[model samples]
Target: MAEIAVLGAQGQLGRQFLAVLGRRARGLGRAELDLGDADAIERTLRRLRPQVVINAAAFNDVDGAELRRQQALAVNAEGPAELARLARTLGYRLVHFSTDYVFGGDRLRRPRRESDAPAPVNFYGYSKLLGEEAVLGAGAAALVVRVAHLYGGPSWSAGRANLVERFLARARAGQPLVITRGQTLNPTSVRDLVPAVLALLRRRSAGLYHLTGSGPCAAAEFAREACRHAGLCAKIQWISRDPRPARRARYTPLANQRWSQEGLPPMPHWRSSLAEYLLSAQNLPIRD
Candidate 1:
């Protein structure tokens, strides 16, 4: 049994991590543990004393981050830095999650690698990249994982609706679902991500890795696929321009070269995982 402690335990990814850990782990939700509060985190860590601490908490509002840069930096950058410091001092392995927005490749087709130089275009991405640097710079045995567009399963209590659910809702209502066509990303399912994360943890791997679905797809394509998988009539409208304040990358498909190099099997493609998620009992809409 692995002694693991999951921060952001109620999040989509965090919930999946706990399910994988089962009785061997303890979870710390927002009320239980605030990443912004370094003293609180230290006290909780001292109490749990888990061998591995997974920091899944983040200020994930991409557009909102443009409005609240300080808050985003506090949670996304400073908090992780403190956690890394604690992990180093307390002798625990730290596993942190990052985003694909760290790269400035809007026109590039190839997926970004762990060794690629990070040049974030938005405040949110910059903050996440900073967090990753903080963890590694702290000199802790840390694994910094950068994942692509993520959607989760039935058991997720992420405190907000997922992309699939939001799309399904708009589709079922016969509403015109507008998705960005200009941006291309690999949509990774939490179903597949949990196992990949577990494999990395089992190896107790350190440094950076990219974990995402295999294919690069546009958001509109993803919406159409989700609607098709759910057997819903969708009126998906494609939009090349996003009016949002945050500057999103046009192409950010991540390649799991490091994961493969580490001898782990490749993850399923986005379509394959989307079909499985759409067919889940919780994801299905009630029939008239």
Candidate 2:
């Protein structure tokens, strides 16, 4: 069994990584391994000596990154660089997660491929792109997986409410909801993502991969689908993307063509995955 260590274990994706890895994995959150601290990360990795280090930790505040550029670069860029260096020295495989925001949606590309040039529209995306560069530059055995519009999996998701949660919350209260229109993305669930990621690791795949739901849809479409699965009859209002505090890319959907060509299994469509997530939430395990 490969010795696996997951950073940011408290996050939605991290928790699912832990659940998937089971006893073969050790999870380290900020308290155990702070990505911002270089010496601390090196020391902990030395002590643990994990054969595979999965960097699920990230400063994922897209809007906040604009204000905290230095903070974002520290955790999102420098942190992954350090991890890559350590992985090289320790002879371990490094798996890092990035975001689909790296691509500028205004470009002609509809669904971004692994080989597409990255032109981030926001500070957060730029930081993650830097992290990818840092990790790849270190020349270690690494895989940089980029994902988008992530939701579902563990209930404890670092205090971030996903699209489904936001829609369901308003629907349950019978309140009117306003969702952005014109903006399109593939809303992905962590449950569908985790197993695919594991398989990639098992196959020792290297380089970058874009993993998300199969199809793209507007944010309003995603909300309506969630409503259908959750059985919520709530009025929804669609609004233009203008007048937002932060500038978001318009149509940044990721394509898994490279992964597919590699003969790996395809990810389920957005609606199917969303339905599974809603069902899973209702069937939590009971403990005596």
lDDT digits (tens) for residues 1-288 of candidate 1: 348899988888888888778988888899999888888989988888889998888999999999998899989999999889988889999999999989976766788888778899999999999999999899998999999777975433545878788888788788988777776788989889888887888888888999998888887888888887877777967777777899877888888999888777879988889988777787665543
Q: Write the per-residue lDDT of candidate 2 for residues 12-116, one digit (tens) a residue.
A: 889989988899999999999999999999999999999999999999888899999999999999999999999899989999999988987665748888888
Weakest lDDT window of 10 consecutive positions for candidate 1: 152-161
User: What TM-score would every model get versus the actual structure?
Assistant: 0.94, 0.93
Candidate 2, clashing residue pairs?
Answer: none
* Full-model lDDT for every candidate: 0.85, 0.86
Model 1: lDDT to the true structure: 0.85
CA RMSD (A), model 1: 1.8
Pairs clashing within candidate 1: none
